[model samples]
Target: VDQGHEVHVAYQTSGNIAVHDWDALRYAEFMLEFSEQHGDISEVEQKLYRKVIKFLRNKKSSDADLPEVRSIKGLIRRGEARAGARFTGLDDNHIHFLDMPFYETGRTRKKPLGEADIQVVADLMQKVKPHQVYAAGDLADPHGTHRVCLDAIFGAYKWLEKESWIKDCWLWLYRGAWHEWAIHEIEMAVPMSPQQLRRKRQAIFMHQSQKDRPPFPGSDNREFWQRAEDRNRDTANTYRALGLAEYEAMEAFVRWKG
Candidate 1:
């Protein structure tokens, strides 16, 4: 975006399942309290919050969140995403939430990838006609959302392969914090300065709901930002060991050819 190229961030799912029930309940309670004190919130909104609070309070740890509660959680994630994007200098119009049908199950186990989900991604590709598409290539994610989302993008890419813009569009695969591309497999390495890394951390900090103890902390107890920073610095160290110029941090990506 800084280079005058258009950029858009698309989230394939609502990410509602990742939000903890306790977090949702706390947010609901806060909203209800705010509504009571300010009297600015609509009656409908207040009633919905009340229902969500009540349902979440009684919800079992094994039970899925109520639809309303799930929606609230989804909203929280969406707001965080938008804030992060804005912090990175993107307009609201450029940030998209596909909320693919397969991921709307409101459970940790999502539905099988279907045509509707692929079409949602395809529609965005058609609309943007982007020159570059970055997809999550992290198949090792414990939650499996990354693999499903990547499959959706692959489906969309195949569906649009005959289009005129397809020839110009390049797909790039990025691994998550859990894994990094092998040194030889990495097609590109973008170096980052200390200042740039600090800014990256700040951008990630926009997701307040994910701060401290994230619902899915995985095996690593460190926060998401810490994981990211460590991963980048480790990549840079690997490059340095290979006799390359040293950098404070580096982001690695592998270009996908289909």
Candidate 2:
């Protein structure tokens, strides 16, 4: 966006399943409190909260979340995504939630990638006609959401490869917490100054829901921002070791042929 490029962020999943029950319950409780404080607690709102609370109380570890619970969690994630986008200087209109069907199972185990999911991604890419597309290259994510989303993008590209806009479009992949791009695989190394790195950390902090005690902290146990900073600094160190200029941090990306 700073480069005068029109940038849009499309979140392909609601990420409802990753929301911990405790977080959902607290949010629900807050809503109940908010409605009461406003002196407009509708009977329907009260009833809905009652139902959600009851369902959660009896919910087993293996049981799927109630649809109402799932919706609340999804909204929570959407709110966080929008907040993160805004923190990065994006307007609300430029933020999109694709909510791909394959990821709406309300369970950790998602459905296989389907044609509908591909069409949703394809439609967005075609509509945006973006010159560059950046996607997560973390196929080793234990949750498997990253892999599923990457697959959808690949599938979408197959549908749009013949389109004229695609000829100008370039796809870039960035590694996630699981790993960083190898030095040989990195085609672009965006060096970040100290202030820029701090700004990046602040931007990441916008996702409050994922802070402190995220539902799935994975094996590293560090916060998302910590992991990001460590990975970036390590990438920069690697570059310096290779006799390149030292940077506070770096973001590495690989241009995807497909």
Candidate 3:
């Protein structure tokens, strides 16, 4: 910001225990609510109930508050993002980690895009008066996080725009864990040399647990590194396959359209 570039990172959720306690609590809460209010208990509800019970049994030996778990996950994600940004040249202060509220529930279902989330983001954008805002927009993300997160970012940007704070800033959306922008489609391709790749990996390492056990919604288990490396190499290789010069790894981004 001091040097004229202002950037921000908006995470969609407290992803740390997103899968464990968050989902588990959601399972428990839903079962309790459904069993009390509704007459027909669908298989989905019953299934979730059973899962919640299992989680409780598991938690019997541990201490895990919903917010605490979410916070831990948030910190891991925040640290990794900061490290990645540092490796890529964005400063630590440039990043604003908004640990959005609706996600704090130990329950499974998160709140809709509320004023609280949008206001905080909008205020930041307004204060910075940034020329650009980069966000994750993986609406097709299987975990539903991509969708929820994008909703919040879009909501915030739109709110800022309505308040006339958006005239100076352009919002850019990057796909989340599942995908990256194709080379031909990329408006910006931040290439990583071997040294940079090492740095990027170190940055990714800051994510700690996410590097190993990302909050996969279901049983398909693969580390974030495996996914990211495969995606990065495949992207570079694809470019090579298409006759472009190959690089060790690359971070690609597409300019988002409203």
By TM-score, who's the top model here? 2
Mind giving the per-residue lDDT tens digits that candidate 3 earns over 163-226?
Answer: 5647766766665467677666777766667886676567677665565565553443666666
TM-scores for every candidate against the unseen true structure = 0.96, 0.96, 0.68
Clashes of each: 0, 0, 3
Clashing pairs in 1: none
Estimate the lDDT of model 3.
0.64
Tell me, what's the RMSD of every candidate? 1.4, 1.2, 10.8
Off by over 4 Å in 1: 40-44
lDDT of 2 by residue, 1-258 (tens): 777878899999998987888888888888888888998988998999988987887789989898999999999999988988888889999999999999988887889999999999999998889999999998878788999999999999999988998988989999866689889999999999999888888877877778887877778888889889999999999999999999999999999896
lDDT per residue (tens digit) for residues 1-258 in model 1: 777878999999998988878888888999899889987998798888888888998988888788888899999999999999999889899999999999888777889999999999999999999999988898878788898999999999999999999889999997765788899999989999999899889989998888898887788888889988999999999999999999999999999887
- Which whole-number lDDT from 0 to 100 does residue 211 have in model 2? 85
